[model samples]
Target chain A: MTADAAVVVENAEKWFGLNPALANVSLRVHPGEFVALLGRNGAGKSTLLRVVARLVKPNRGRVRIWGVDVARDPERGRERIGLVAHQTYLYPGLTARENLRLHARLHRLEGAGERVAAALTEAGLNLSADRPVRGFSRGMQQRLAIARATLHGPELVLLDEPFTGLDLEAAELLSERLRQWAAAGRTIVMATHNLEQGLEGVTRWVLLDRGRIVTEWTGDSTAVRSRYRQFLKGAPPGAQGRRT
Target chain B: MKGLQKHLGLVALLAMMAALYAIFVLAPVELTMGVVQKIFYFHVSSAWVGFLAIYLVCFCSLRFLRNRDRQWDIRAAAAAEVGAVFLTLNLVSGPIWAKPVWGIWWTWDARLTTTFVLWLIYMGYLMLRRLVDSPEQRARLSAVVSIFGAVNALVVYMANRWWRTQHPQPVIAGGEDSGLHPDMLLALLVTVLAFTLLFFCLWKMGCDLERTRDSVESLRRTAQRHLREVR
Candidate 1:
């Protein structure tokens, strides 16, 4: 593991019973590298991101976050990671601000009140901070989830399908937040089916097909969508399956 | 390995049968309650096993929280299911025992009430798991509830000791003068041992069923994905 690498997944393989979700996948993410994982559904993009976040374990191999092996010391590994999964990971009964405070307490953040206040403002949820999250719109909930994930100021952030239910304006807000985090030297690995949207402003793009890295490209988002479409056309039928 | 499990299961069944014989034919009947006292052998044993199963749930829940492993969560859920089944048996049999002895099918005794509450809490725990869609969230929420339920178990166990009620004092731990006959104690011990073994067999079976269900679900997802790709 390199000292500068924020996340390292080496020869990782994970299986859900008979279905192989991740097969011999290895990747190293350095500090401030915004990696956009692009693939069709069931291409193992989410699984790979989950492995780096230590939310799921690999059947055979190791994942290291900032030079610390996750399997050996999961608590410490989790301390440095902030994950925004497909599920918002929020309590429906709690208000947006209350949910952030609970997350702050879990991460043992210092100056939790101030940090939560700032996170709410950053997510544009300050006005609705006291409203129960159950009453919030899907886009509002997604924004709150983003705020909750980044509340502890983690060094590495893993987002799985973060743009799934967002409107145009919410998407733009999230994009701005991602750019700001990247500028602050935080490593980000995002899995998204929105190829064109994901490629914008990302440092690198990796295409996964059937649990394997099929191709990689960096720089220029203008033609990336066409390249991704071409790659999908050439992939086997099973590799183009719907997401699990 | 499966053959070994089958053999062990058969052994447990045979041992249970032997315990029944010991309870009915070998052990002398109580002078006061006669045949109705027979239910005490299995009733007390099942209650012990039920409490043990819930404790196992608590232990597995704590482990799941510490490691965030799905295996631990599965174990905790299986234990809770088995625990709930045994607790149901205990509650039903208690009413059967109570109808003839106390002339009432139920009572608001401290011990009885607390045990019922404990059952409700765990049943709610299972319901909470069913309501949650995500596996991670379900595990986290259920773990917190299970820990609280385990703490409630302590209160249930001590209820009879703390308060006087219509419920009979504990036969095993009812102070110096309240000891059982040597022969009766031996019979109870054998029955308890049999029930503990039975609990383990049921728990293992439940765990196996859960694992198979998960595998089938995964396979179904894979098949669905394949069908979508072909379309």
Candidate 2:
């Protein structure tokens, strides 16, 4: 294991009784790597991220977050991982500051008040900190979601469709922040449907046709794009056979 | 936790049975209602458990809202379901016991009216879960409802004390009624313990079932993915 490998999975298998959701899924996320998880609906993107976050357990595998087994130390393991999804994961009735303060309390952070202020400022949400989240627009709410994710400063960030409802400018601003976070040596794994957005800031790509990873590439956008298109065309036809 | 889960249902069942036996075999017949007073044991026990369960749900939900652990949400859900069942029994048995003792199947008494309102509030909570689209939304929304329901429960408990009622005066020495006899009090305590255990067992089972359902849904998604790839 390298120092940069923020996440390591070995033979991870998750199943629902007789049905296997993720089979022998193995991956390594190095520090500062912005990797995109590309797969169609029901492609195990959320499942994979949830397993790493210790939100769900794998049937037969080991996931080590920064060399700590999540099963053995879920609380400690979670300290190093943060997750953001399409949902705001916030209380609509509470002010942005109050909502962030609640999470800070859960994380048991000292001086949470100052940290929350700093995070809100960094996310360009200083103007709306005292306002209720329900009053914010979609893009503004999304910014708060990012601020919440970065408040604790986890080593690895998992984003599930961070750009789902964003305007082009909002998308670009968030994309820039994503790059900044990764540049600070934090690992990022984002699952998105927008190939154009997914392709940005990502050096390594893993394409999923179904549950299984049909192919993976380290670099060379041209080669990766060509392979991606081929997988897209050839994937659906052979998807059922590659499931196991 | 497992010990708590294991004994939860059993304790309640055993206590209720013991109380029933004591009511019939040990405690002498009441001067007023004779053998019909037996219903009081289970009646009070159900109300005790029902109120306690809802209170527990409120506490857990507050913690869940404070902390975003979905586990606390699960605990709250368990408490709500168990609370609903026992509260139903509380309301139903009250009417049954009232018919023989008070000569009426239904009463417009303040306590009974407040309890019915509580039952309606929780029923709405259950309905809200079904209407929600996502788990995150479900948990947050449920937490808010739980807090409101809990506050309503306090009002229900105080309804009789808060206002004078047309209900019959208490026969015992506490508030409207006199205290129970030594034997009756012991049996009542035992029944309370038994019902508390039963509530835990039922709650644990419900949580386990919910987790299994979530697991199965994720599994189906996985299977569907495999089929998609093969197509």
Candidate 3:
């Protein structure tokens, strides 16, 4: 990892009271790198993504997103980041189109009307764009959320379980989009348990266990799939520790 | 924490003790209003501190909007909560002090009415915070509400002057001839100081508690989401 890396998390640590949520996690992702964070339920992959997205401040460490230090000036760094957490981050009261318009206004994007329209088309929600987001199916909301996250053309995209609730067709379409995004050189860090769907566009796989980076691998999908299956088979249940 | 803030709580405790002595003993009873006039010391001090708290809310909320820093948001939330508590004290004490002096339990005068509305605004601000689930969205919405509430605070402060109601005129800054008795003024200043110091102490503790709660909530939400993904 160098200064030119898209994301640089240096010796990151997060503690919840007496318990450690993340411990000495340092990762560096070059531009356009698609890194899949693979782990069991409480492995802290989501925490790592949140730290990188500047949603959660680390107890001890420095995070630089697109060369901007998150601690010192997280706002500047956030302009380059597109984060899709488990929550859709959409207002249920507003229609899908209105939601996109609000997002466009919040970001102050030029040509907001055209951008919102394009986002609706891209999310495959053109027919339902005028309907309230509360009425949309989970898959539709997720699609709209993905579009909204990318609306500002951010340089880095952080996805936490993006494949949740997606149909096979929608999942494949999102994977294809991820492949395109990686091809066009936009960094992505996706944390997902759907190993089969997540492996489609990943350039590398990083395994986390008990808040620490256990190992990482770069190989064919089938080889990584077998390795993931073997690792899960050996692990115990409800084992990762955090009290607060 | 570098300077005065490091010893704020201890200083506040000492000031509280000093204020009690001054309010109950040092200040002579008013011939016009009797011993119940003693409530004035605390009532006015609570209003002043309430103003300070709401003003801090506006200032920190603006900073949060500009910087998008969660610390600023937390500060604004803390100030809003503390402000609401003090405003509630102001509201309750006004009625208790009024029942004896004005010979009525309540009046819909400009000052009292505006002050009541201010308290209501704070309740709405707090309710909005609880209603929003997303942390960022909650911060943004609460910041906007706080900025608006500051306008009401200004109106509440000026209600006695602007509308000329049953509430007494401002004794501290009304004019050269409107000053309070020397001992009473001294007592008022001491109590205000004590209250201001205490506000900061509470605010600091509130911010610390909020930080802990935010971390725990964030972690818990992520864990629940992760579990759902697995399921």
Best candidate according to lDDT: 3
Query: Candidate 2 lDDT (Cα, whole model)?
Result: 0.78
Candidate 2's residue-wise lDDT over B16-107, tens digit each?
Answer: 68766777777777777777777787778888887787778888889876755667777888888888898899898888878886677876
Q: Which stretches of model 1 miss by more than 4 angstroms?
A: A9-25, A42-190, A198-203, A209-214, A234-244, B1-4, B66-71, B165-179
The residue-by-residue lDDT of candidate 3 on A1-244, one tens digit each, is 3568999999998764334669999999999889999998779999999998788877789999867898999878888888876678999999999998988888889999999999899888999999999998878888888888889999999999888878777677778878878888899999988877756668899999878998999976889998889888653335333212
Clash count in backbone of candidate 3:
0
Q: How displaced is residue B178 in candidate 1, in Å? A: 3.5
Query: Once all C-alphas are superposed, what RMSD does model 3 give against the true structure?
Result: 7.3
Score residue B187 of candidate 2 by CA lDDT. Answer: 69
Give the per-residue Cα lDDT of candidate 2 at B32: 72
DockQ of each: 0.16, 0.11, 0.06
Q: Which stretches of candidate 3 lie over 4 Å from their true place?
A: A1-33, A41-160, A172-189, A198-201, A208-214, A230-244, B1-26, B56-83, B108-110, B132-144, B155-179, B194-231
The complex in candidate 3 yields a DockQ of 0.06
Off by over 4 Å in 2: A1-38, A42-221, A230-244, B1-12, B165-176, B229-231
Q: Among all windows of ten consecutive residues in candidate 1 chain B, which has the lowest summed lDDT?
A: B168-177
**Candidate 3 clashes between residue pairs 3 or more apart in a chain or in different chains:** none
**Worst ten-residue run, lDDT, model 2 chain B?**
B168-177
Considering every candidate listed, which one attains the maximal DockQ?
1
Ranking by lDDT: 3, 1, 2
Better of 1 and 3 by DockQ: 1
Which of the numbered candidates is closest to the native, going by highest TM-score?
Answer: 1
